[model samples]
Target: MGLFYSLRGFFRSPGAPPRDAGIQSGQPGGYSSESAAEVTFDSAMQISPVWAAVKLISETIGSMPFNIYEVGPEGRKIATAHPLHRVLTRKPNQYQTDVEFWESMALNLAISGNAYAIIQRLGNEIVGLLPVSSSQVETTLLNDGTVVHAYTTGANVKVYGPQSMWHVKLFGNGIVGLSPLSYARNSIGIAIAADNRVSRVYSNGAKPSGVLTIDKTLTEAQRAQVRASFAGLEAGNDDRLFVLEAGMQYQQISMTPQDIQLLDSRRFQIEDIGRFFGVPSILLNQTFGQSSLGSNVYEILAAFYKLNLRPYLEKFEASVPRWLMEADEAGRYECEFDFDAALLRADLQTRMQANREAINSGQLTPNEARIDEGRPALPGGDKLLIQGAMIPIENAGLKPVQEVPSGTQESEPR
Candidate 1:
């Protein structure tokens, strides 16, 4: 079920003719035959780099605040106290907390290009949203142009209508979304290959193979005996040490230069995977001694939020109300992913400066600024405050009334 749509029809069913075992001829769409079986969301996760990148994006998004609001007629927005909010915060279902639910949704959307949740409602009110595993799901279209999703695992299959499921897609037509893992298969294959090679080296007692050479020729029986003797030394903890007869030599078979290059290729592959996921390499903790803006965590975080996270937030903000609320109610309600907390998380000095500017510019009341700083508001703080000396630039041309000389008596004309 984790299969890519490219392989959707290539799979076998009982009544269908046997097809090539998930292997397609030629490198169709940049994916080689060798990696067709390994490009699944689950398989991609097996590579450490892929997992790290996916986790970084998913967790960052999951930690963001999801808010529901009511937009009034005059275009004012207010936080809404809806049952869905309680359900999202307390338990989306029996298994997931708000964080866990959103994290899973993000992970699926990142890897498979789709996230699905089964909506459970009591009467007309939705009380829960249970996540369905993306790996176990398939989407199909009907003749009437309706889209249906079927979830199957083992012997069980469940089908859901559009209203019963909350589905979010990334970079796809109205019906189906394309998986990023499919496009990133080649880079992931390189990482997986590198990991496998290193694992094999360690599995063989961390010893490189070598060519055993002798100064003189030996009989077949003698050669067999020599091979057995070497096997005895190389089989166990003694692998680090080797004993040879006089005039016998063991020359280690060093990896060729081309083979050695694959080690460096692994590092580059991490960046490649990051690009496919739209996450900067620096966010993946990859600093290859090059200059990086990530040295300032706040700057990189801001870039990440704007470039990678905002578009996704917009998608959900639009989709949630459309699917979760009644049409009439949807007109009045809005969903938003709040970044205020992140904006307020700047260094103490920067946050203080920002607060000062906002307060002085009349953009925020004293109480509001203090609330953002997590401080108690003082009396009279609710009033908007601006700098006392701040005046209109046009007023600069007007001179204050010429004050009467302090020592002179006021004019009698008064």
Candidate 2:
């Protein structure tokens, strides 16, 4: 089977606009401009079909905050706040100092092989630097030929490296620990021991033998990749398992009616939010949840969409109508208007024409006007332009607004 078959289930024809496509292009009853702008794919699914699935889900459902649950090695049930949930539930008292400290520590370990470090920001003053080291950073090639760098603190057990940086934390007595090695080996068991400080590692029914610790000096890129991977993991888990149990008490605080009400009141419902906003929602929903104090799935989702998603969609939506109008007037929509292929093609054609004209006008030599496959090739070139001639459209009378000359002003210059 091909990679597409491995990822997506099967290939099907792209569907036409639904008779009652709720909101099309921002208008009611008809497809909203936003909805109309979306393109449905008809091609075979790729190896990672989740990307397309996520895009479709975001476009269809907007963005709602969700909870995530996962079973680590030994069936240890673990639950935490979704990152989206955290944003919605952000409070004035919430601070990033602790998180930042561990993050810095993770980065340092990635680059310098140093694990111990301190993060200081005293109203713009340097404060302290702690001792840390990377006991090991070894690259292991997988069966797929992917080289994975395993960074370990001590013993054969691997400490979370660039992949699991977020879980690294410095608890009481300044002790830091890595997330369990479940990602690498599922049956490899890990148990938080009675001390509440150390994690006991067990593999294949053997007694819990090893301990886990954190690596402090991870690089910014490593930190980002780790964070993104964690987010993806959380999203996968949310869709797959509901690990959290509602009505469960925490620290003697009952999950009561009032608490549920509070959570509902603060949580943001994802119904029609766009895809960009959905990224944060997926992140938060996977990271934080209702159980997260001062932060719930709703609040995190609400804040992210409000703070991030809305503005992005607005800008994107605003640009579409003009492009659509242009395509309509030109009677030549791109292979996929929803994908903005026409606009890309037009832009490419314009640049290529300019370059050709420049060469013709003695502004550049033939050598200077080179054509290379990878060198910013013009979109919808002669071949693609011919291929794009078959776009089907119901109307072609809508004229797009043309750019006016710089001197042609509607009002006096400020």
Scored by lDDT, the top model is: 1
Residues 139-160, candidate 1, lDDT per residue (tens digit)? 7666666677788979998888
| Reference-based lDDT, residue 309, model 1 | 72
Tens-place lDDT per residue, model 2, 1-414, is 224322322343334312221111110112112221112121111111223323433342222222223334554222343221122122201343333433434333322222332222234322332323333443333454333334455566543322222212211111222211111111111111111111111111212222222345668996575555433222232333222223321132233324345333323322112122234434434333432222544554455545544433333233222321233422321111121121122345766786667554545444444452125434433221111222222223345568879877777688
* Model 1 worst lDDT window (10 residues): 18-27
Candidate 1 has what TM-score?
0.81
Model 1, residue 358: distance off in Å is 1.4
lDDT of each: 0.73, 0.30
Once superposed on the true structure, which residue ranges of model 1 sit more than 4 Å away at CA? 1-30, 36-43, 215-220, 232-243, 251-259, 291-294, 389-414
Question: How many residue pairs clash in all the candidates, one count each?
Answer: 0, 51
